[model samples]
Target: MEAAMSTPGRGLTWSLRGRGPADVPVVADPGPWPPDSGGPAATGRGVRVCVVDSGVERDHPAVGRVDGSWVVVKDPDTGETSVRPTETGDSCGHGTACAGIVRRTAPECELHSVRVLGERFSGTGDVLLAGLRWAVEQGFDLVNLSLSTTRDRFARELHELADQAYFARTVIVASAHNTPVESFPWRFASVISVGSHQEDDPGLHLYNPSPPVEFFAPGQNVPVPWLGGATIRTTGNSFATPYITGLCARLLSAHPSMTAFQLKNALYLSAANVRFRSLPSLPAGEASDESSESDEPGELHRSRESPEPPEPRLAAGADGTGN
Candidate 1:
């Protein structure tokens, strides 16, 4: 299923327009901690990764190895949601692709599948919320949310759930909508928001200085697993999310004590776009003027003294108030 479904407000910008490498400023290096120190031997041996998407085919060759699986069943009459253990297959192959990507990245990480979306690649916000809440409660080390809710009514509830996962040390890696439409869970700063980059290397990803999206990974024309034990080349932010999820599995497996915040910091430091050397600065007068109005659109204008830009502030927590 295409990640960018034709939903309202889907035409928003998802790409950085008219920007080049030279436009990015070089900043001094911050020494790296929570090192991405493990290899395949440390491939998430003790870490757990949960894919909160459509569903993962437990036996597909690409996703041939999964540790466990769960499906969410909702009662239409009563509007109640419950989880039941099942060895189900992918509903639309999207979840299988995500699972395969994560497995490829973190070969040894224990994998769990949660079915929220159905064959049409859609689900209700209530169901999504219920699945997310359960995942947080389970305390999985890393929860991947490739789907998001656009309804404003669920924003507060989803925000609370994201924060709950945040404080519980369950890092939520969510995908930004393929279109620029406003979406929940991913927009919340408590979760690590990811988007697609036009790159082919699965291991490569970049850090976004901009808000709403914090990371970009290979999501275009990528080969991913499909239903029926086959593979196809597809593209979407959905596929890109699992790449980071896999990397997180490796990091968490190596540094068991690292919190979600620390894991994010390590990712920023290790990103390919991160600069270790400081760039030449303009005169103080020129700097002040540049900040007021920039000739280049979308050029990030921050003080050069700081090694990195500040992270986006957390949105209002469960109570509809800022943290």
Candidate 2:
């Protein structure tokens, strides 16, 4: 029997036991609820996604039609926070890169940008929380947070917000920190956490039989839009995260009322490595069979190497986690 572990809010997220690449085999059985990424099914027509990063460049061709823009403002004197509309663009190109990935994956999804990181990608932990709270309150279908806080003090607040997003059906797709260090939101079971994979196929993603980081997507040497409508190749878990976010948007667009948990299940079943024991049709707005869902994952096989540390940026650390 495969081993399983439970998480807060989310129960028995992983149903199998495997560590690293060799242990997780690729079974050919198609899962009961296979994730469909066919062209017509998921264009992200009706989904709303909030990119909470440095900020997204307006009309950068790659990231077209940003429906709204907001910034988290902190009172330098009182240290209070508020969210306001902004005409500003990306501060250090990170947010634009993430936003561009989402656009490429799900072209029709409504995109919104909220600037939590400023010039040189410098911002505080409180500011991160404020921006995240605002994004969650907006009821956005998905929030792509490529940044995180390493401070233990901020963990509880981030967890609460993650739970809030989970129960509200506002799925939060967060990136696992580039280093093996501890971080927020992404570590929370209530959120869909992602890490990077070394694969040429952008369409490929795999489920780990382990816990903590749930899925691995494309995040190495990715071609993405940068400042001034320029394109650059970058590598990091940050880039891989939007790949999952884009998928979530597409899934939600197809299944309009899918909760974060349900959407995550579809992602798991859709994973290239998942093997189906029996093909069971899932009712709309429900999870797959008995906690673990599909049988032990063993489908498509690929390189599962842990991504190296992200390339260094010129800025002062990422916005949020103090450098």
Candidate 3:
């Protein structure tokens, strides 16, 4: 049996007994579900999970039932675009995969689909921006962004939109590129960025000191729902992103009043195999307010012999248009 204990000085600390990571004091897991979660969290009753991707097939067996759907349509002649209500359907199965994952993670949460990508899994940044902005304004509790833009020109607008979602308390879980390229929105600190990990357990996750990519979940050759009520095994950050989105839905449902900041803290604290060397300590009385942003990549917790420099990784687009 593994034993855990927490110390009440400076910040919360835990010591585990067993062959896990040695007996060194570690940070406590602040996940909403207990370590031994045998079933889904019932708190996801009324929460809303919005997937901003290549539309979702709401009626698909994996996706079950969808509450609402919207698609970004561009006027070919003028290039102007607007979001309009549409029938729930997927373009090429990418969005449906994400929605399916969320459904599997939080079965009771209301699911909404916002289609931004087209048949080729490609779309202009403006359309992506429009879809995301609408979702934030609508006040969805969680938004899943399995796609990103590699263009630098959209950085400013994307950053502003990310911050807007953050301030609005809408948690946007974005995915990092599988390749070594630059991208936007996912790299923004305001959003929860996820990467792939070589694990079979869907509930497993890890925290990385590396910027841009903050967390890692199962993304390797995992089976996911695809087009036309079918299933396929695929690999990419795109698939990995929805896992975190589902988890966020569960957390938000458990704590309906939690702000984005609070939800983020809960994730960080609950991450598996967390390392505290690069994590900053929370100041007294600062854990319950907006100022807690410092706790993320802030001041160092313990003295270091020599910290390894973070490696730069390229960002890739997640249009689900497999190349």
- Any runs in candidate 2 off by more than 4 Å, and if so which? 1-40, 119-123, 278-323
- What ranges in model 1 sit over 4 Å off? 1-41, 119-122, 278-323
After superposition on all CA atoms, what RMSD does each candidate show versus the true structure? 13.4, 13.8, 15.2
**Superposed model 3: Cα runs more than 4 Å off:** 1-43, 119-122, 275-323
Q: For residues 225-323, what per-residue lDDT tens digits would candidate 2 score against the true structure?
A: 999999999999999999889888776655565667666776775676654454445779876766444444553233323221121111001111110
- Per candidate, the number of residue pairs that clash is 0, 4, 3
Per-residue lDDT tens digits for candidate 3, residues 1-323, read: 01112335533344443546555555532333332454234435678989999898867888888999999887777877789999858878889999988888777789999999883334568888889989998999899999888888888888988887887788899989778889878999999999999988766777787766988888988788888889888888898888888777766655566677766665565566544544435667654544455455645454322221121010000100011
lDDT of every model, 2 decimals:
0.76, 0.79, 0.74
- Comparison by TM-score, 2 against 3, better one: 2
Which candidate, 1 or 3, has the higher lDDT? 1
lDDT, candidate 2, at 225 = 97
Error of 3 at 199 (Å): 1.8
Score candidate 1 by lDDT: 0.76
Residue 243, model 1, lDDT: 88
Q: After superposition, how far is residue 277 of candidate 2 from its true place, in Å?
A: 4.0
